[model samples]
Target chain A: MQQGPDKRFLLLTASLLAALLLGIIVATGMGYMAIGAGDILKIIASRLGGGEALLTDLEPTIPYVVLEVRLPRILTAALVGAGLAMSGVVYQGILLNPLADPYTLGISSGAAFGASLALFANMTLFGHFSTPLFAFVGAILTLLVVMRLSTFNGQISAQTLILSGVIVGAILSAGISFLKYLADEQVAIIIFWLMGSFAASTWQGTGLVAAALLVGLLVSLFFSRDLNIMSLGRRSSDALGVETARVRVLLLLTASLVTAVCVAVTGIIGFIGLIVPHLMRYLVGPDNRRLLPVSTLAGALLLLLADTLTRAVLPVEVPIGVLTALIGGPFFCLIFRQKQKARSYE
Target chain B: MSEQELFAIDQLSFAYGLRPVLDNISLTITPGRFYGIVGPNGCGKTTFLDLLSGGRRPAGGTIRFLGRPLPAYPKRQLARQLALVPQEFDTGFGFTVEEIVLMGRHPHIDRFASPGPEDWRQVDLALERIGIGDLRHRLTGTLSGGQKQRAVVARALAQNTPVLLLDEATASLDIQYTLQIFNLARLLVEDEGRTVVAVVHDLNLAAAYCDQLFFLRDGEIHRSGAVAATMTAETIAEVFGVTCQVGWNDFSQARQLSYRYRSHGGITAAPSPAGLGGSDGA
Candidate 1:
């Protein structure tokens, strides 16, 4: 009898993994100079370990565009999506609020402010890596501040955490706006970064985001059962032996690190983190044990498709961030309405 | 501390900053009996239960469970020995009833291990015992109030602990379901040798179900003993500021108490001969 749901969950996860793989391959094949699916797989295989001899026959520019440009951008987009969505799952579970996401704790605003300052001042202390480093620092500091502000006598209340996030986030947003006003010649650079794009994605950025996603996924899955019990609220989860305070802090720090890495790499790509987990919850239910992995794959697929649409299908390039919100905002509204209707019936 | 005592609370004092909730309260809970903590609205009944479950630390004193200080035991080990059924819960995400019950196995299962066959058997037995086996697949949020409370009780049962603490766990249920929970608590104590402590609002229900009753007034145990001796009309009037008639009920074979508000002073009449007419239906 219990086999029914587990089987369905297994099938869903398998299908999602397949879909993500297909999405990445198909998306890599799309661009101004379109490559065939066969060549795309060959390039991926050859890059993995098949040796340079396999790619020797391909046109130099084809390999260059696919490997040097499109692949890095595509992989970064997918990994950022995965990290955001996974962190979103942890945040929502920890806070016990559906409206929560990776950015609910103001990590995005912190990253944006850091990047904005770097751009405005032309700080090249870290050479090409300066802006992202600043963003990472900013996000970590913001998380620390929020954690400190919310924690009272070693316990972090969910309501206080969110309140602190909003307060800090609002101040940071204002700071970013002030920086934008001060950045006369560099205003375009600041604006573009704030708008968010994957056109500048590189192998190093992809590697960094990938490493973060891997760590985040492992930690989240380890605590998924405890996260489930935590939905019963603090007192009850404590009674159930969850060690709620320790688990809550560890998960919160892990999730914030993942969000910080994603933001530092891809700028603020909202909505994917906020909506992908919710969408997958509707399909898979809210057991984070199943929900986290499935949502990770689905988030990767959704963002890859969105980036492909903006990069290949659209005549003029629109910021991928704008495209996702445009697509996700309405989809979320639909899900919310359906949920309300279902509850009314109950 | 006696070997037979499940909990030996020694001068346990808790406060909310300066305002004391439970002050210098001491009690010993023994195995194989049902204990009820009854009090007025703000009489620290829930706080006392919280202390026993190790949810809160006593400000001034100590609580020893099974001859060891409560804090000395690792959380998971302690959870394996005891379980708490809370009064109100929000299953924030729409987890299924089975999933909720399976959480009872948390302390028993290793951190990395999933629930095995034995865990499933326990969950199934708990669901069956709570009479909600058919509702296992349904989402907890979709269940009615009484059904949700029953699922929570089943979760506690699945924990398979030696001690069960209930903090007004039946306040929302209708009389029928309320009686069902109390009866289940009694069965667990009498047959399984589990120690059960409940914070109940209904005096007659506590009297009917619990082997030992602790009456709390102003954060102190005003009276504590066997139900027949501790549940006098004078105790009820002093603790609750109301007038009650205590009598024997032949139908249920339990001491029953019926109360009327002192504010309604004009309507003085002989105590209703139908003593505890409401609980008789159960």
Candidate 2:
């Protein structure tokens, strides 16, 4: 009897993962350079095996473009998507709210504030990494402050945490606006960065997001069952032996960490975190054990496709954040409408 | 603390900030009996249940379960010993009836492992026991009020604990479902020797099913005894400030009570919980 859901989950996860792998292979070959799929696979195989001799047959520029120029950005986009979606699953589960996402706790705003300050000051402390470093710090600090404000004698109420995030986010947003006003000529750079993109992605950025996503996924899946029981409200979960407070804190912190790392690397990619889990939930049911993994795969594929469209398919490169919202908003509406109609019919 | 006592509450006291809810209450719950906690609104019946279920620590008391301090037991271990069915469940998520019942096996299942065949068997048995077998795959949100309550009770049944605590679980159900729930609890006590502690607002229903009754008033136990011993007109008036006549009902073979308001010439402005029994005030 239980095999029905489990089999469906396994089949869904396998197909999505296969699709993601196929996407990566195809996406790495696309762009103005137009590397062939076979050459792309050879390049990846040689690089992974640490055998440069296998790649000498191709033009030198082709290897450089495939490995140094394109591969990092593609992997980074996928990883960031996966991280954001996984964190979204945790956020929605812990808050027991459909609207919650990775950025719901003001983490994105905090990162934006830090990036704005660095841009406004024309900082070059860490060369190209200066703004991202600052943004990461700002996100972590905001998370700490929100947690502190929400904690009353070591208990964090979901409602209080959200309210605290809104309060802090509003203040930080005002600060960003003031900085933008003062920038004069520099405001365009700030606005573009806030719009979010993966153009500046490097191997190091890819590695960072991948590492965070792996750890976050493991932690999330481990406590996914406990997360399901938490939706029963605090008292029943406590009676069911979920240790609600401890599990909530652990998952919240872990999710925030994953989200901070992703935002630091990608600037401010939106929609994937908020929409992927919801979409997956519709297909997979609300069992977090199934929903979390499937959403991660779907997110990785979705953002990969989006980034590919901007980088190669489109006449001009559009910000990944803007594209996601533009596309995701409508698709989400369609699903919502369809679901509502189905319920009414029932 | 005797080994036979399931819960021994000593000087239990609780307060919602400055305002007291339960004060200096002492009670003991033995195994293999149906206990109905009856009280008017704001009389701390729910709080007493909360204390027993370890949802809240008493402000000034010691609650011992199985001869050990309640807090000393680990959360999962405590769940294996006792289960609680709340008033109602509300969620925006779509969890099937089977999934909800399987959650009762949480304490038994390991964190890294999924529910095994045995756990699924328990879920099936619980569903059958609660007469919800046909609705196993249905989403809980789509269930009727009575069906949802039965599903929740089935969850507790799946927990397979020695004791079950219900906090006004049938308050929203119709009379038929209410009687069905009470009958289920009575079966657990009579056939399985499981302890059932329920917070009930209906006096006659409590009298029919519960072996022992505890009436609470002003955060204290106003009376506690068998229905035949403690149920009377004077006790009802003192605890609830309403007049009632206690009589036996042959159909149910249990003591029944009919409530009436005290004659005050005209309706008073003060709010009362009990409704008018007849057009002519007693």
Candidate 3:
């Protein structure tokens, strides 16, 4: 007797994701030293085949730009996007607040501070290892601090949580500023890092990001039912056989790890983490079984598209962070306005 | 009543910070009995419900379910036996009524397992039982207060537990809805032979429907017994700090209560026994 809405939301999300991926690949191929779709495929096929034939025919710079440079950057964007979006979904579910995003818990600022410290200290012992590790550590520490500060009598009130997050974020930002002040005269590196860029995107960065994203997304799916119950409120969830506090702590730790890894690789690329999950929620509803996977795919597509635009739309090359903030700012305002309208009706 | 005790609280005491909410209280509920817990606000009715439902651990003493300590039974096992319909819940996401009700199957379903036909059948039956079957496809957020309360009760009923605990299950509902829910509870007790415990504020409703009533005062059981014996005017006035007259109505075969307000330095007059005889005329 219970035949739900016959329309399948999954098919819609999948088709949209496929279209976005195709659009991104085509758009990225249209950069200054344009590679035709046929050549792009040929190069990819040749590389997969472990042959250097495609490289022999192409202009020396073309393969380097497409395969070595832009491909890793695009993959990095997608990985970071998926990770951030997964974190955003988990954070929002745990907080039971729609306004919650990855940054709301200070994870982003903490990672940024860690990266800044790495830059200032000139920690080149293990090359790229120091930055990501420090970022992950910093994010987890910030999460712990915020959790400890907000808790009162074993319950974390909404007001105290938000306040603690803001306070922690402010402190992390101050730390980042301190690092910037101590930075060498070569201020371009600091500025670029702060504004966020994909200039340093590499195979190693993409691999790290992909690993973190996959693990985080998988773990979150396992806890999807708990998250669904948590959205109902802590007391009800507890009554429903969910260990609310333990589940919440695990979710926060997992989300923070993902956010830290993403921020470490690509600074603070805003909006994808905040908006992708929200859009997915609006489209597919709040069933996390659908929400998490769809949000991950949508987040990947969005960042890839944004990265493509950043490369294709300008002559001097735009930082991805600038593009994301510019796009996300308007989208955030639009959503805020819609929420206000909805609230007014209530 | 069945000899099997569904829930037993032994010298249970709980406090919020410095103030004790439940103080050295002990009670036992048996199978197939309709138990009504009534008390003034801040008198520990809800706290006692919480203890029974495993929502709170008592600071002192112990709670046992089915001859075993509550902590010994795994959470899911305990949930399988006892279902709670909380007073209020806020759900931000808009789950359809059918979907929300189906969550009651959580304790029964295995991890990563999809709901089978049996689950859906239970959900449909629950919705039908609550008389909200037509509203199954509607979002829970759009439901009225009474409908929401019914939906929650439907969820609890869907759990298929032998025992049910409700905290003010009909507090915000209209008279019609309140009667409907109480009638459903009565059916569960009489027809299904399940143990139903509810904390109700309306004394008349409790007296009219419940087989037994438990009156709580200051976290302790002030009085408890058959409804007629426990719901006298003296106990009501003493527990609630309000003057009320308890009477019987033969037309409805129900006990009724009429409340009176007392002014300063005024002596409250006792209800006359002749007024009790008016039940025959009605």
Candidate 4:
């Protein structure tokens, strides 16, 4: 009898994930004028099955948009979503705070600064490779600074970590604004990049982001038991022979690495990381073994759906980040309300 | 079998930054003995337990277990021999009671290995031993304070370590649960012949259950010996600064220490009513 509900829940989760993926593919395919679901599937099948003539037979413009344009954007959305959610799980686990997200520790601001600097100076290094490399470096440097500042007298309190992150984030934001001031008439490009978009996404960029996110997620899953112990609080975890400080440092570095890669590839896509894990926790419970994987899949689906909406909602393409904020802000308020109700009873 | 010290702390000293929490503390715990540490709050009792458990390194002295330096032992190996039941834990996750208990077997588990049938059996037995078997499937967060303490003890029991260190594991528990945990610790000592060391705040509980007692005051050892010799009213007054009387309880087969009200100006008369079996008026 007990197994019945557990099995049903698992089945429901798997079906929901599959349905979401299919819905994103269909919605993205329907965005263009010439393409339909059937034609999109035929093109995808012909390309995947290595049938060149069958793929070429589809409308020239249709295949180009479906394969080259929409596909890369959808894929990038999925990668960024996964990266953000994985980092969220790691940060929340290590800090033992549910509100911890990748961006909460100033990683996004650091990435913004790096990207803006690249844009303002026309840095050839950031151009040759993806901007993510510079963003990754900037994010890591900021994380190191925040960690050093937070560790006063050889101890890191939760309050100190949060405060340091806020201060450093403000500093980095100011630096980005300075870069914008120095930027020429090309400042519009810098401004749009800061706002975040999927317009510049490519298959190569999507692939790199996906690989980095996959590595991060796999490593986190392997250490799920350690993460579980960490949620018990640091002192008790250390007493249990966990080497708490070492675990926290490793997790923070890994989460930052994932965040830098994602933010560099697709500007700051907000709320998926912050809200997806919170929702998944309420749905499937807070066991990291289940929580991490479920959140990754759910986040990917949410971002893909949101990106599809961005393309379909207006004749002109809306920035994916704007849509996420517009939708996520109200969702965030709902979560706060729920939390308030829960706190009242407690 | 001739001689083996399970734990030996020699001139161990530690401080938080530079505050000097523990100073020149030397003690030895042998196999199959129940040792109790009693001290006033902020007297470095918990810090001493933390040092012995390898959670903190002593600034001055050495700690040896099984004739090897404490730091030399690999973390997993040391965990196999010693298990610590902390004073309080929130356990803020969705782990079941059985799952929490089974974590004690982590040291014995190999990488990527799942718990075996024996591990599950041991966890079941531990829950049963702690008398919380019925709550096995319940989430740890939903349990009451007494139940949570029992679950933690169950986790330590499942560890199956030879030496157990409990740092006020019963502080927040009710009297019944407190006695229950003490009785369980006694059973481990008597039946399994395990060495148990507890940092306890209650003096009576220490006198009743501890085979040996160590009293700490201001980061220094005030007294140490068999319970009958070290738990006298004079020693209690000297260490705790309380006027108390000591007597034997025939029914419980243990010593009992009772404290009297303070006299004027915190001074008491000679042959005061603090003595056991004395009249209301001295």
Per-candidate TM-scores read: 0.94, 0.94, 0.91, 0.91
- After superposition, the stretches of candidate 1 with alpha carbons farther than 4 Å from their true spots are B266-282
* Candidate 2 per-residue C-alpha lDDT over B119-218 given as tens digits, one digit per residue, 9 for 90 to 100: 8889988898777899998988787777777888888889999899998888778887788788888988999999999998888988899999999877
* Candidate 4: tens digits of C-alpha lDDT, residues A139-164: 88899999999995465656678778
- Could you arrange the candidates by TM-score from highest to lowest? 1, 2, 3, 4
Share of native C-alpha contacts between chains A and B (below 8 angstroms) recovered by candidate 3: 0.40
Full-model lDDT for every candidate: 0.87, 0.86, 0.80, 0.79
- What's the residue-level lDDT of A159 in candidate 4? 62
Write the candidate numbers in order of decreasing lDDT. 1, 2, 3, 4
- TM-score (2 decimals) of chain A in model 2: 0.96
- Candidate 1 local lDDT, B61-96, one digit each (tens): 899999999988877888999899987776667888
Clashing pairs in 2: none
Give the least accurate 10-residue stretch of model 3 chain A, judged by summed lDDT. Answer: A1-10
- Tens digits of per-residue lDDT, candidate 3, B31-81, equal 898999998766778878888888777889988887888878767788788
Candidate 2 Cα errors over 4 Å, as ranges: A152-154, A344-346, B261-282
Model 1 docking category: medium
Best by DockQ: 1
Docking class of 3: acceptable
3 against 4, candidate with superior DockQ: 3
DockQ score of each predicted structure, in the order shown: 0.51, 0.47, 0.37, 0.34
Q: What is the interface RMSD of each candidate, in Å?
A: 1.9, 2.8, 2.3, 2.8
lDDT leader: 1
